[model samples]
Target: MSETIALSFEEIPYDWRVPGTYVEVRPSYTNLGVLGFPARALLIGQQLAAGTATPATPYRITRLDQAKRLFGAGSVAAAMAEAFLAANTTSDLTMIGLADPGDGVAASGSLTLSGTPGASGVLALYIAGRRVPVTVAAGAALNDIAAAIRAAIAADPDLPVTASGTLATVTLTAKHAGAVGNQIDVRLNRLPGEATPPGLAVAITPLSGGAGAPDVGAALAAIAAEWYTDIAVAWTDSANLLALTSELAARYAAMGRLDAHAYAGLAGSFGQLAAAGAALNSPHLTLIGARASPSPPWAWAAALCGVATFHLANDPARQLRSLALPGIAAPAQADRFTPTEQDLLLRDGISTFDVARDGAVRLSRVITTYQTSPLAVEDTAWLDVMVPKTLSRIRYDWSGYVSLTYARHKLADDGSPAAEHAEAVVTPRQMHGAWAARCKLYERQGWIEDAERTVAESVFQRSASDRNRLEARQKVRVIGNLMVLAAMLQFEA
Candidate 1:
């Protein structure tokens, strides 16, 4: 005696309640990723604007790597130079030499030291981290400036040389060597005993009173504002990208099983949006849809007999009730049926439907005819309809009707296809075989728990911790799988 017997309705007594499907407790999970792109962008942008980081250049990453490596060896000069060149190609700054007391001497009286270097700007003289005072003398050589510095040093031993240009007068650490109203005059000169030095006068003048502090506060404030603005813009752009990713994820969640034509539209739209998003540096997105497989065993069995029900297409009545409540809800369908030029068809005894777009086929109607007994399970169906027409006639189906009208279908060779025409379509027959095989295997292998575990684990992995950067992604995938399972249920019965 087998655990269960397989019999048709005819073999079993009508009074006895046969094995039928009923709804079971079901649960689902979703996942998504939500990266804060704007925040990252703002951080990087602020760093660049604040001068904490240099402007990025072509190969900037490579140069930064090289600079890091060279820093440990005390040979970063070359690497720094390379990074500088890589960052900037026009303006440049160079280091000359250290400023220390030596090389020259200074006197109190209006002694002048002059050895002009270049016409870049006013000559700068830093001595012991302080400025030395000097005035330029017209038409003086660098050597003459050096000679004057020597003489000043000889006159006053208290004055000591701090720094000197390669071709200009030597600078002293202090402008005043205990002399009241002391002044310095620098004439362009060269090094002592040199044949000839540059004639440019590099002069330094030390005033009597204390120097005034430069007011750079206003300038610094402006710079700070600029840095903040740059960061904000970067952040805004990044935020938009994150927002778009979220929107895409939501869109995919709403997707469902498509008729052949609807599938075509969806596939096309997805491809276009995905490409555009990639170009905008947008994160990749996923969409969920019904697959060719049914839901879990119990769920599938319940759905096959129309017992288990998932969320339905938005119903106007439900929407009205929700609006009366406190929180927002999904969109609802219109109260009245909106008709278009296209015809709708509902397959007999199946939940699947189709929308036909062709000539002279404007509407469809479902006409169910009762038989003496219900059809047997696992049996193929056959039907033939003859219609007298002046021209070729076409047949199409939709959610609630089957359309028969005068329309010609393009054929490559002979009139009708060889019974196995592989036209694009979404019918129960096309989806059931695959579902049944998988369901039987699943039952035999007892893999229902595995499937549930996989889904649950995936959801956890996406929402792992508080940073579910991929929450949207998970949602789309979940929705797509649900759609597939829903479609499978219609035929898996």
Candidate 2:
């Protein structure tokens, strides 16, 4: 009934007949009279999930500090991440070359403004990639020309590389090679005991090649590592775990019970064992805990349970909970079997517990068999039973289907039942509330066609839209409202 809380009575057409004059037949159903999932059931469900051994700690996300610790301080990767975060996206360096008279080119030898040679004894230096003229020294020798060029480069490594010997003419190379003006700096290194490195009219030219920036692979890797580590820590926090547990429990509460298919739908995995659940009309419930990797022993056990095949250690203890009553329809009948919270207890006297079961537990398996006899056929109407099983664990496969077992019941020395009993059970993953919520959103967005299409596709594909569907619909609604508002304003005007 809780599950159908949102479903309108109009949606479910029911037949009614009047046998007595006092009351109308089924006078307007009272909101389905649906009860929220019982707290015991949820406790049992959580217990079922907790039955298995705790999961091995999950792999933590990488952290900046952790990465630094692993890689080292001031390492290439670390530095890259630190510095590259601020790298300019648009700025670039350009290289250009200058040609001078020393590269087997003639110098215009005159202080004259025009083509008058030998007029004023002025030596003209030819620098490439520019129209400006550089004047020769007043009494400069060939060496002084080369020396001046060297001095220019020594001042700035960003200067283009230039050479001026006959065999190795004054050619300047850029630190970063590229097209003209792509150079960063040029340098002039002085050799030992040469009084003056010729300050020749050297042409400074930028080289073409290798002027691009460094790849950011290392930086990205460092950042990723840091991000993951932080995520891992947050995920493992106790507060977060408790909150998630409650949230997931509430989701299950929205649904009356967890069936195998529903569990698979919710958890987002469907392996062979999950398929096996589909094979049976009444598959077992499997409650899961801890977001762990698939290869753990508990996971294997969970998978086995999915197929009803977990090799439970022989539990010699005969401490099963009280058998449930079957075929009880009215609230009066249900009250007899529904024990108050104080009545249940663990062997250690712990009262707090959660219960989840594989199916509608109107009666115990034994009680069902007893009522199945031919003599009881008429009495055994369509009533269902509710049982309280203390489950300690549920296991799962890679596909997220659960398998489970109960803790061995404790017995008294005289073969009488002990004062306290521990019931072990496993419940199925109840991720359906989330999925159902999404399906509702998708339908609202007029994506019913897409929803059906996805359902027909593989299960994994169907799960892919769960998170995005709601957001997509919200976006659609926003746009639709805006359009309507604009149209209404236009019409008013």
Each prediction's total of clashing residue pairs, residues at least 3 apart in sequence or on different chains, is 51, 78
Error of 2 at 375 (Å): 72
Q: Give the TM-score of candidate 2.
A: 0.19
Candidate 2 Cα outliers beyond 4 Å, as residue runs: 1-136, 157-169, 176-206, 209-219, 225-471, 476-493
State in Å the error of residue 49, model 2: 58
Clashes counted in candidate 1 amount to: 51
Give the TM-scores of the predictions, in the order they appear. 0.14, 0.19
61-140 per-residue lDDT for model 1 (tens digits): 23333433322111112222232333232321221111111332323222244445433222233221122323335454
lDDT tens readout by residue for model 2, 344-385: 211111111122252211211211111222443333221111
Q: Tell me the spans in candidate 1 whose CA falls farther than 4 Å from its real position.
A: 1-109, 112-188, 192-208, 225-493
Which lDDT values do the candidates have, in the order given? 0.22, 0.22
